[model samples]
Target: MASESPEMNRLHPFSAVTTTLNRGIVGLSVPFFLIGVLSSVTDAVDPVWSIYLAPIGLVAGVAYGLTYYYRFEYALTQDTFDLSSGVFSRRSREIPFRRIQNVDVRQGLVQQLLGVAVVTIETAGGGDTEAQLNFVSEDEANRLQREIRRLTAAANGERSATEAETASSDEDEDEEATSNETADLETAATPERHSDPGVSEDERHEQPVDHGEPTRLFELSSRELGLYSFTSFSFAAVGGVLFLLLFANDAIFGLLISMAEPLGGPANLDSASPLEYGVFGIISLVNGLALTYLFSVVYTFLGYYGFQVGRAGEDLVYERGLLQRYSGSIPLEKVQSLTVSDNPLQRQIGYAGLWIETAGYGPDSGGGSQSAIPLARKRRVYGFAERLSGLERPSFRRPTTVARRRYLGRYSIIAGVVVAGAFGLSLVTAVENWWLAAVVFLAVPPAAHLRWVNLGYYVGEDNLVIRSGFWKRRTTVVPYYRLQTVSTRRSIFQRRLGLASLVVDTASSRTFFWATPTIYDLEYEVAREINETTRQRLQSALRERARSSDSEDGDAGVSVAFT
Candidate 1:
């Protein structure tokens, strides 16, 4: 029996009343409660004001939400996926099945409680707002994944060995078999097999492919997301202990309060003594430690409300959301590398964050997909990356941190300019005599260098990782295949020094390496090599995909799975 096209699949039943009410309740009810409480406690305004204003707000919210909701629509065809959405305006996005890079299903706290998840579909378009979905059932999410995978496979298998095999097998069984058929099948055998990697003798003998999560797959629960966020010593995964400490101090006790309540006196007071302050300091230290732990627990519950990740068909699905949903999916082929990392404190906690890099997406949308696998089983990282690699040969070889040390020089230079510019401006604006200029010149260089040193990026043959920041450092990874375009850049100064930068642009993003990290002065040698390697890698992938198609004889096996 022929499978139904995706458009014929069930549409999510719409309930205008329920959806409108949900918007009203969420937007208006909260405000009403707050204002009601305020009215009761203080006579800031008339009690009747909130009663009338609250309903008006509720009505407005419902109207706006429903207007937007009604405009949104998504449906799938046999070969292309269509998403049309807008409130006052309309946008119809059509993406071919083969262009889909990944599918992500996510649920936030509210959606989880309501038993709905958001499905984000990513394509090769390279546009912002890459993810799109409001709420879909768990079953629907899986079905979509299987269906899309089937479509891609079909696109890949157009002229596959299966066609020749089936055609030849049919011919052999028929008494009317044409003599020309046997010769054609034999001619096609080699190219057909080459076109599809799974089209060999082993495939002929193997069982049919199954689009189900492996029975042995591991998963995380909502509680685990919260627990891992709290207990996992992946301190660096969240924030630095040093800065967290300072933040904790300022939050709990105001700067003004702390200064005013100092044991002896404020810094301006001559009578203030270190001995007197020491007594209060010990007590404050204990209070700060306890409060910091509490603060983290609160943050965890609020941020990672319904985080979950596990196997989905032939790949991995990671879902997370708080108030709004965010999800990411990594096809086996799209993944470039996998890594596990821990800071010194995190190592002690016996828990580490799972690190993932794909062809181009990253933590900030420029690199490979990133997941802070909170509370990852320490031993599983190796086996997981290896398993995925087995399914899809990585575009590059081993992961390399060669880019790590190289980043510091460029970082230092950028920081030097920014800091020096600020201080230099201060010098020009300062009053005559300009005693502040001396201080400005003295302070800027070291401060900028320290700022640069705070961030680092690592590169591997298969994956590239870049991390930057002082107070809030972020790390991103990009894979080679996901790269849509590659270019080398050189500023006049950098060109003079012979240093060049590489930018790996995906459809929706640009992953930039400004100035070769290793060589302080620009080196054209490194820049040309990176640009050349990127071009070669991209060409090879396209050729392989194209050749595979020709071999398959043009019939793509769209895996329309039975839910």
Candidate 2:
């Protein structure tokens, strides 16, 4: 591969055209669209002038693309990958092999057309500290990522061997030097002697598991995608329709009226009979809904058309997409938490999705949590979560049945406030119907009861499990050592009820709601007990890891999850 070439290499020359075209189209699309709208609505400029702008933009884009192609250069070494790129002020970055956390290969519409892919390198340091080689051949992109993985593994193995050798030499020297010391002193020093100062905590804990070859975990079938299209929420479709209405309402309505003119369309609602207006409204709504649903199905299907997930060595690999394929791998050890989600409707049909939360690559990463299983049965969800988490089926300690009253009370207060306001307004205006408010009040009790039943917390042998959400249920499993903060909160209502909420915070931010995974409506005493136990677990896990690092045997006290 050219990436493996000893000399610094530039991207495929054709990248210049692709990059320029992609950026220019996206950057100038809005302005050009506005110009078109203005030209149609008002004769601001001759139609021929608009045609000239396109060629000018294309020429400028080509020039910029050529400059970028010449300026970009990258080199892959045994220990580091260096990248240099800048049009005016040159900037260079060196990403050490050891710090690389993830490698992703993406082929967008433009890259696909150009027969190239973009390779993104993300490091453990997080944030915008990432490098991208935007125009490598698809094969080279994959090969480059594999090459980096191989080099990183080799470097880690070499480091481990060196540490083991150093530890052995130190043990021998300690045995010789302590020969004259008392037996008790020698025994104490023996334990401390095995602790190699050369090994970092992460290295000591990273004991390789014997998974053998890459194992296929799950793949989304066409049937499954069809099921997901119906079960999965597609809010984007609604947003698209709203965007069309907001930006091109006049053009869209005009087109619709023109199409319906032969059928006695009510273009002027004021001149139409009541029945005609009603028929027109119904047609428009049905058309909008049908369009929205179709758009949603197509968009969702295209995004996850050929999803495949597997375990490759110590990493979890995910590859999906139809028109623009995306491939990424996450080290198993970087997974901070595992989650399973299913809405009430989905749960009824025995469908749920499994997701993993990794450090840095959280909700802001665009895709939210990385999906392990896009769509699966409930049993598969538990099985995959267990395999990924190295934990048996997750179960809660207790359902907050006792807190049903608290939930009902809080919800009743909210419902009452709405009902009272509506009742007051109804006295002055008939449109603010008191009966409508009463109908909403009727649903509050059931909603509160459902929430109470779903809220629970479990203190497992190796993990802390939190379950909540009734309509869209979510179960979060996080290791004790991964916990960054554990706290108890008391709302005024909960405080009055002698109850507190236990919140478990982990390094994974994808567990979004940023409200954290909380166990709500617990007795104050029980909450305190759980909090204390969680803290002890964290300390114990940390100590065990420390002991593992100090042991001469590689597997002495290794955490099962990391292994």
Which candidate tops TM-score?
Answer: 2
Stretches off by above 4 angstroms in model 2 are: 1-5, 19-64, 124-129, 159-213, 247-268, 272-291, 362-368, 424-432, 511-514, 550-563
Tens digits of per-residue lDDT for model 2, 215-329: 4556787778888877776678898888887886667877665555456667664587766676677777777888888878887787788998865554677888888888887
Looking at candidate 2, the ten consecutive residues that score lowest on lDDT are: 177-186
lDDT of 1 by residue, 359-389 (tens): 4334323444466465554444333433333
TM-score of 1: 0.52
TM-score of each: 0.52, 0.78
Kindly give the number of clashing pairs for every candidate: 31, 0
- What C-alpha lDDT do the candidate models reach, one value each? 0.50, 0.70
Error of 1 at 215 (Å): 5.7
